[model samples]
Target: MLLPSRPAPVLALALLLPPLAAAAQTPMTATEFEAYATGKTLTYAQGGTIFGTEQYLPNRRVRWAFTAQECQEGHWYEADSQICFVYESESDPQCWAFWQEGGRLKARFAGDPDGTELTEVEQSKTPLACAGPDVGV
Candidate 1:
């Protein structure tokens, strides 16, 4: 009996793809995102580093604080299949595409195919903190 020949590189590549394929998450809508995030403080990470954290409140309200930046309060809404956020400090909206991976969520900055990506790494009862008179507000 003759055995079929297979390229070693191709076989190795095929074997390595299962985990990668499983990591791809289905994109989420605004409704789904809000339902999942409400009343929770979610910490996001990028490239194994803590990126920032956001506290989700009722009625689409959000408070976001970067690792080394001031905390900004914002609200999110759905527009054209993207979840766009507008902060009180910055009127311009920052949009993102959210994906649900198992019990966590991931996001990619909008309009940049190769830009920054974020994955949820933690959820805490304590909210984000900021300095100034508007810190806890």
Candidate 2:
């Protein structure tokens, strides 16, 4: 008696899917992002070097500071499936696509997957430290 053979094409397709699925990361929706980031401070790195840190506050407000720099106040909103931020220092909106991977947030500028990518290095519940205006006066 001859045994039935498995579908070769189906098997091949299944084998090819795992890597593709893993590579295709889905961007988080606005609700998911807010729930994950609110009341948290996240530090991001680019090219394995520290880039900046952001503290997420209620009502979509945020505070961002570069390494050892003064903080800037901003607010974020969802636009065209991307998170767009407007800072008090700059009126132009800076947009990014955010996703969760490895239990941390990953962001790409302008939703460009091949462009600059920032990886979250640390997360905390502590608020960001912002020095008062005119320090060392």
Candidate 3:
């Protein structure tokens, strides 16, 4: 007798992936990115380690909290078809290449040789718990 499987297995597969691995081939636009990120707090992980969390707010406002440090307030903007963020603590803009994968957002560090990639592990409506500075919610 052939027994049916319970939960269907999700194959880890990518079709004709580009040189920039982890990218969704087509990068997300500013409008699409804003629409997908707003009102959600997203948890990102890299190399199986919980990196940090960022809460997206209206007007492209963002509150980022590293796991080992205090939170920083930042705002993201679109430049050259890439999403870049400038935080109060840093002058250099941290840019990223974003894409949608399986209904979830994934990001790759843009214009860097580090090959640092982050996957959206979790998301919620709850805001990030920020402390230690004059950062807005």
Candidate 4:
């Protein structure tokens, strides 16, 4: 005799869940990015190693630094479905596509030869430390 099965319901429930890979693939819009990053400092890691950290300030302004390195002041803007950043040290824009998954941010550099990708390892409300000219009293 044919009987009800749990596998069918489980399969249906699984199908109802959003695809995490696809969600991660879709880049966050500028508004979404700003809402997530503004007033927060985020640390990123690459290949399981600490890469750098950035503090997002008001009006899209930012301060970025490599591990134990001096910070660079920059600003970010949206350009053709990508977020582009310009730093005082480098005029050339560095573009990236950013997304959030599992409440963490991920970034992929545009036109990177090594296919570099960064994952946010930590986030905080504290500001970044920049010890140099134009920083602190």
Highest lDDT: which candidate?
A: 4
Model 1: CA > 4 A from native: 1-24, 133-137
TM-score of each: 0.75, 0.78, 0.79, 0.78
The lowest-lDDT stretch of 10 consecutive residues in candidate 2 is: 1-10
Angstrom error of the Cα, residue 107, model 4: value is: 0.2
- Give the Å shift of residue 7 in candidate 2: 50
- Clash count for each candidate, listed in order shown: 0, 0, 0, 0
Per-residue alpha-carbon lDDT of candidate 1 for residues 1-137, written as tens digits (9 for 90 to 100): 00012211233333544555534656688889888989899988766677778888899999988776777888889987778888887757888878887678878666543444677999986777765666657
lDDT of 4 by residue, 1-137 (tens): 00011212223333554656533489889999999999999998766677789999999998998777778889999998888988888768888889887889988677564345678999999999766765655
User: Residue by residue across 16-50, what tens digits does model 2's lDDT show?
Assistant: 44556434889888999999999999998766677
**Residue 103 local lDDT, model 2:** 92
Q: Candidate 2: deviation at residue 106, Å? A: 0.4
Clashing pairs in 2: none
Q: What's model 2's lDDT at 42?
A: 91
